[model samples]
Target: MSIAVAVISSDTEYVTRMMSYMKGSPIYHTWRLQLYTNPERIHQLTELERMELIIVEEHLHSSLLRRLQAGGGQLDELVYTSKRGAIPIIVLAAERRELLEHELYKFQSVSALLHGMQQRYERFRSGHAKKRLVTDDRQQTIAFCSTLEQAGKTVMALHVAALLASKGYRVFYCNLERWNTSDSFLAGRVLQEQAASYSDLLYVVKSRQNASKWLAEHAAAVEEYSFYMLRPFQHEADRRGLTTEDAQRLVAAIAESGLFDHVLVDLPAGLDDWTLPLLQQCHAHYMLLLPQPGWQRKHQLAMSCVERHNAQALEELQHKRLLVLSEPYGNCQPGSSVSDLESLPYVEAWQQGDPVLLGSVHYRAAVERCIQPLLTGEKVV
Candidate 1:
């Protein structure tokens, strides 16, 4: 009952190095790993003899892929990576901290490993003879990030909706700021639905201005049901405490919906009075920072606030999240380099800038354009 692995690599150096590394590891003893670069040779192996996992480097021939696809047996996994841009597919990795935008974009083209592995394996283990019919209530997660300004959060929410749509998940992008101040397009409906229960669940709050209007305008395709995107409150909080209750209700509704997958909370920038409670509710947090000249100071300040709020045993936060350094926008200063930021252990660093930031206005504009794609899982490039 030994598991089998197939390594298909274009780079001789990489293949040699990885094989050397694997041979020394304990996994090598339990799994039968075969190296292949020839398609005809692979066909000779029987179904049972076929490798369960295939690690193919970029530049693999199409004939090889078609053959593999036609094999019709269970393909437990496939790993595609390359030095050049030949292979453009990715499987999400929790530990993939500094992966480039180009690499991240590959996930869209090549099916996500989560879909291939976790979802499928769960079906197989459930005693289903064939593939499980994926239902609308399946669990999923959507990530959202934005700068401190009004536009950043708004745009981030829209992009998140777009991403969920792309993935065939039901999604609703709710921007509370745009709900109905009489300044925007959402001021039509005035219906009240009392006794609505809200916890960590995602639900639709009736718009006071225009219910039908907004629904018609913002209703994403059914596939977008996977997530619901919402903008963080700009005022931070009030004497009545609008954000806390609103957030609680939203979270509760999302948890109860059984239809919505993830409720991506796009929070305001800097250390706000209400940031802690919100962070506590989240399973993970993405601390977005700008790489200004004084970024070190800002980074430390942001980290301190997070530390104080999460306060776990021995200076650790139970929620394992990373600090994502976004490009600077608005009046904020430009961000520091990734290499410079990664030096900080308390933060997992990322850079969304190209050619670095030169000035305030230029950097702000750059930041705005840079993050637009990230909201919807689009690659940075």
Candidate 2:
């Protein structure tokens, strides 16, 4: 089904227009177009490798067509535009037929002729009834927070997005670190253009910058956060770069965007200054963990952040369950294992929290195992 189509015409505009139409056709997925802007290049393709179709304009030098015929180029079809027509030539001319008959006899291989090539393609596609699949609403967003030490967040986000999209959700991969790469906002434009279709928009929030830009870009998606943190960043110096107030504004904007019915914010390890404020902003918060020795340190921070933030936010935080990211990279340090996480005392302490323990996600292939299932609503092993 993969056919190569060559358009031989000096009018790049017409060539481009024809190709554009071809690209959107049902056969488009089956064919690839190559432009032969010069006649010499056309001569380069051997007879054995001639394209499936050769579209040429009559204005092209006669020597070029002779070169094509010499190259053993037997196109599946030839569409020629000229003031005169002959057998098998698709004549495109405003002039009378008498002028074309003389020229038409010069070519013997033309099998079919159509005056308007563009309209022919349209009729061909309509006869086939090629339906364009419109994106619909079934989007879901999940927040992913990993210790800054691991840059695995991006991998996790993209994996989930692809999985959900494959399963029929209008999934978006949001990158907070680089605001410009916000997928939800980018998808928003597509959603607006096809307003009749219901396409669920899932936004992955990685950081405050992600939230900030989504607001600025006016991306609409069902709000979902991997986690929400009160203290977005720790360094007092970095705090000056963006404030809690700015984050709050972005949060409000997201809430109002109609992007998601559920928003999950992935919280970073340890409740810092941003923890309380962020918890207050979200409808839900999850104390995500990777059952390891660090749980002890993480537990203390979580408790402190939950308690100090506000009783209500703390209750909200407590009600949220422990989301154990079971998957660990296979290349973990030789000695690292799940048992290392089980021994952490903080796990037991967390069990007694306000939200209570939600159960555990055993380490597995996070993207292929965990993320794909979550996005696709399919069971993961």
Candidate 3:
């Protein structure tokens, strides 16, 4: 399952350092690295040892490119064959300089170099490679949204993702909220040196590039929770500039990537150009409602506005929408008017000032029951 990579560099010392770092890093388990101190030895890559990626030192890049263009070797055959063609070539420079599409600076940390290589390979695969075959059982996309602030939509979304992952399903949790707070609850935050910002991923999506590869490369695993999650947006403008088309394409790429069994999206309150498409694209929409007065009216107004813009989208939302009453603070009793609707029980631990409410077993069990019908494809009674 490891991705094959070959590095050709005349700098013996640099190659040694890189090999040492790879041996000590977690990436060693995911990538197979082959080092070559002589550029001519690259021809030794036979059919038995095909490389998915090739990295050339700046001094040897030109000569390698020429040889590749001239053709007639195992390397040439590997790069030109239809079945495994379009293997990516990356150039590593000694210092920061005007870089080409696949060129990277060499003096950076090994982690950064590996991250850059993964990003380049994914872009090449998404744009130049053929599409992968999708199976009959397509991945399901679920959205958690609410019109009221503090409605616990994100809390519910994370719990559902945890439950699904525990049940042996691969889950990718995405937070689309303009101001995301999921990080406060999740474990294993990406190291600052290894972090890939959401803005960079958004730019790839906006350029009409497939986001599946980006997700595959950058999605951080929440090992403590047993699910994967994309980093939240760091800036306001980046989230604000997301278009309806961008939203649709991003969701479609993740759902169709064949990487996960379920895609859980946490969305901001209200429907606009950005959120409308997402709401329409999801297989099921879980709308969290607070027990406070007038919250239902606000949701109705939001639906009415969406209807005015796209009637068909409104119809789709109505068809798949599930209303959940969130009573996290114990403001309402079980026998209240909203009792018929699916309700999340109030956990006293949260009221007792537990910061890590996401780990609450009682709350997660309630969310599991609320989402069980959708997971089983059964109608909610």
Task: Name the candidate that leads on lDDT.
Answer: 3
lDDT of 1 by residue, 1-381 (tens): 254556554455655655565576654565565766555557553632444444444345454556645664333233222221111222223243665322221123223432343243223222221112122334332223322432234333444444434444455543333222211212222122221112111224423233333333433332212333322233333212556656555544443455454455555444444544555554443445555556556566656665676555213323424344443242334344543331111111112322211123333333334333333233321
Please report the candidate that would top TM-score against the real structure. Answer: 3
Rank the candidate models, highest lDDT first. 3, 2, 1
Backbone clashes in candidate 3 total: 0
For every model shown, what is its TM-score relative to the native structure?
Answer: 0.41, 0.35, 0.59
lDDT of 3 by residue, 206-289 (tens): 786767787788777776677887666666788798777766777777788888988888888777766777887887788888
lDDT of 2 by residue, 151-258 (tens): 233334444444344333333333334222223222232233332111111122433345444443444343342221121232333434545555445455455445
Q: What do the candidate models score in CA lDDT, each in turn?
A: 0.39, 0.39, 0.72
What is candidate 2's TM-score against the reference? 0.35
Give RMSD (Å) of candidate 2 vs. truth.
Answer: 19.7
Q: In candidate 1, residue 96 scores what lDDT?
A: 38
